[model samples]
Target chain A: MSARTLLRVLPPVVLLALLAYLPYLSFSVPGVLPGRVNGPGSMQLLATCLVFAGFALSYDVVFGRTGLLSFGHALFIAAGSYLLTVSLADWSMPLPLAVLVALGGTTLLALVVGAVALRVGGIAFAMVTLAFAQAASIIVLRDPAGVTGGEEGKALARDAVPELLVGVANAPYRYWLALGFLVVALVLVRLLVRSRAGHAMAAVRENESRAAVLGLSVYRVKLLALVVGSFLGGLGGVVHALVLGGSGPHLTTAEFTLSLLVMVVLGGAGSTWGAVVGGFLYHYADARLTEASGSGVLDALPGVLQSVLAQPLFVLGAFFVVVVYFAPSGLTGLGGRLVRKGVRT
Target chain B: MSDLVLVLVTGLGLGALYFLAASGLSLVYGLMGVLNFAHGSFMTAGAYAAWLTMDALPGSMAVGLRLLVAAVVAVLVGAAVGVLAEAVLIRPLYRHHIQQVLVTVGLSLASVAAVQGIWGSDPHPVAKPALLAGTVEVLGARLPVDRFLYLAVALALYGGLLALLERTRLGLVIRAGVENRTMVQALGIDVRRTFTVVFGLGGAVAALAGVLYSQYAGTVSPLQGGSLLIYAFIVVVIGGMGSLTGTAVAAMAVGLVQQLANYYAASGIGDLSVVLLLALVLLLRPSSLKGAAA
Candidate 1:
């Protein structure tokens, strides 16, 4: 490849390499980075972070790039997880087939949901999506089918997953599987954003009426984005289920949706790479704060401070409020400004 | 016939709670074009305030008097939180729905965390006042006295709010502002002040709902507000975004559907039915609902 091409390829190549070997690095560096790298305890958190990175990137495709603010994004992720879990646990399907079924089912779901949601634009669309998601969550919790395991959630038996992807005993392998999915997600989203359809999505987002006036099928563009974005979201769910060995009703909560929103917003909405960065930062911070709160390190502090630290959601909320108010464009926007200033200097 | 009466009355009772929860949300949406997701948090806050007040009061006081005092405290606390939230959290992001959603969601999460911090994750039981704890016979059926009280209070609130919006100078200004904020601002009125009041009132209303509903259900959990927020959103959507009357009607309808679905179908079908109804309505008649704000 030419130097220009090499330069273009270098970042993703480096990222892939780092992610692919993260478990090994962590395992080898027990002294430098104790719990997080030395064992399954922290590697499990990293695995989840990888899954969420894919999910957040998919969300960025709609919210960041297409300017479609969807409140029901969790439904896609949960659908993928739940479908895969049920197929494996109930029907005794192979892992590969279960994964295939999940992706296809979620894509169709996105298409149907998108068709209904896209009929209305803006805030109405958001509300419609939220209502659908709420309904789905209620169904999951109700679990009339006796399959979802209701509030306790459904977990995979060791035999249900591929031996390589089973958690704990083969934690590093699970991490690699999650990392591979993230790579697939990144490549897919990058390609989508650079394609002709991607340009169409941008045009529609910029101004729906104008795009419609100019002969762009606004509905089709939106539906296409939703379909592709949700497929990626489902893939994230598959990774979530595979790495964690289970799925739960918690996957469908509005709080979960907000967390995804925070991840995208904290990273910068329209930037694909920003979503990945934001996802890693968010999950890492969340895990660290949760660990700190439970670690009893704050016991020496004042009672009120101890109470505040003990509840990690409060910290996450405070972080979100600060980010939206002071850094609306998120870290990516901040990075962009600094680069621009450097060029000017 | 008694079963029908029971269903209708029970659903209306639930509708009354829905009205109390959603009216403030609808008003804020009308006035500011922002959906306050943290509205439920305010409700939870109100419930906690009432709980605390009742806990602190002298045990020998009359139940009715104690109830009134607790409600006042709850409303006051809710209003204070509202003012503080509006000033600090919501003031900067006016007219941006997406930003408003993001911030309020954050606020909601923060509020949930705060609630969990203060109250812990356990559910607290709100004992109904002695007078409202009795059962009453209506049309050959037994019903709790508190349900009747909730309906009466909800109706009175609905009527009072209507009069305030239709008959009072402030209400007229609020209505006019919702219709055209820039034009109202150009007329030399401090629209910002009106919004602050609206935000605070919205908080008070949601708090009242929280207090009363917790008393009605006999339990208040830290995370209850998050789930209730969903039902409120459904009411707002079904009734038309900004229409108080529409909201009332929609709430009743949802209440009826929920009660009936619970009776006739599987345990969780009620929520599913409401959402499906919303989808069908949106699909079939997106523009027919008259109270769309934007």
Candidate 2:
């Protein structure tokens, strides 16, 4: 490899190496993590963050790269999560078969929903996807025949799963699984974006009519992006279920999908690394902010102010608005600008 | 037969609430090309405003009088919020449709969370006038009096909106802008002001819907606006974006379908059927819903 290529790749490689070694570390981040880096609590949090990072990156494939503003990305994730548990607990499927069923079912769902939703372009497409997702959410919440466990959500069937993935002592294993999922997702997304289809998606995003005039099948390219993005998102959901031990009704809300949008935008859309960073930071902040809210510092504030700051979502949402106004390109874009400015100075 | 009457009247009432919510959404989307996610926040704010108003009033005050005052406060608050949001959050990012939508999304999340933080997530019982709380027999079916109030208020708003759109100078400009904003701008009209006005109007109507919805449910919660917003969104889409008449028609259909299905079939089936209706509408009559203006 050339010197420039080596320089470009070295930082991420080092970062990944450090992350992989995290479970062995004794370091604790006060106020940031609940325990030492190697402890179960911290490991589980990190694993959840990694899964969300992968999920946000998958969303970016459609939202940033392909310019499809879907409000129903949560549906596929929920499908993966609910399907995995159902297959294991109810259908009596083995671990391997259950995983396959979850992933395969999610992918097939994405294809079918995409094909139908893609028929209408722009905001209509968003609404259609949302409607489909809302339908799925209703079905899940209703828990037809009691398979989904309804509002309480279904727990992972321990007996149907492997032993290594079950207990708190095996958090590192789950963390590793989460890391592996992120790496796989990153590789797949990178591969997809580097392909001919990726270029077509970009063209379609820029101007569908012009792309079509240039002999590109706009519809097919969009469908491909949605399918790929959703498939990866489904993978994230599977990892999320494993790391968290179960999927809740929270996963099925439109708010979850919107949060993914916030993460992608916060990290800077259209860039894989930006999404990962955004997703990781968002999940980390969401988890830690609740802790911070109860800390002594917030107690010093006046009643109304303290109450307002107590909700992590309020802070994140306000920050998102500020970012939208000032940092339209997101944190990554802001960083790039700062770097460019430094060089100029 | 009595059950049918109750369901039908109740459906119309629900449809009225949906219309109140969807009308503003339709107008804003029609003229501004913004899907205001914060519209739900506006509803929540209005509901809380009314709740606070009623709570603050002296206990000696008549319940009916207190509610009337609360309704006015809610409407005014909703209008003010709508205008302020448009001027501050929306006007800055003119022409950037996605960013506009995203900002609204952020606003919705932040405001809703703030409300939740302050009030807690649980539903709070809303006080109602004895008249509104009572039931009226209609066609041998005892129906909640609030349902009729919903219908009356919705019809008044609908008629008021129609007159404003069809009769006034501002209405003409708004209508013209929705049809072709550039053309209206080319004619030396400041369409931006109309955007703000439309937003304020939409907000007021949405707030009114929120108040009425709270009355219907007999409770107010931070999440109340969100659940209702989904149906409102469906109504807007099914009716065709920006067409007030279409929104009203679609709202009633969705309401009736939801009520009838919930009653006839399973409980949650109504919600599912409404979605199925949206899908069918989009699939079968895609062109009809495309770029339709007020």
Residues B72-134, candidate 1: write the lDDT tens digits.
999999999888888888888886678888899888988798778867889987766787888
Model 1 residue runs over 4 Å out of place are A26-38, A342-345, B289-294
Distance from true location, Cα of B140 in model 2, Å:
2.2
Q: TM per model?
A: 0.96, 0.98
Chain B TM per candidate, please? 0.96, 0.98
Q: After superposition, how far is residue A313 of candidate 1 from its true place, in Å?
A: 1.5
Q: Per-candidate interface C-alpha RMSD?
A: 1.6, 1.0
**DockQ measured for candidate 1:** 0.70
Top candidate by TM-score = 2
User: How many clashes does the backbone of model 2 have?
Assistant: 0
DockQ of each: 0.70, 0.77
lDDT by residue (A91-179, candidate 1, tens digit) is 88988899999999999999999998888777667778888888888878888679888899889756976678774768888777778
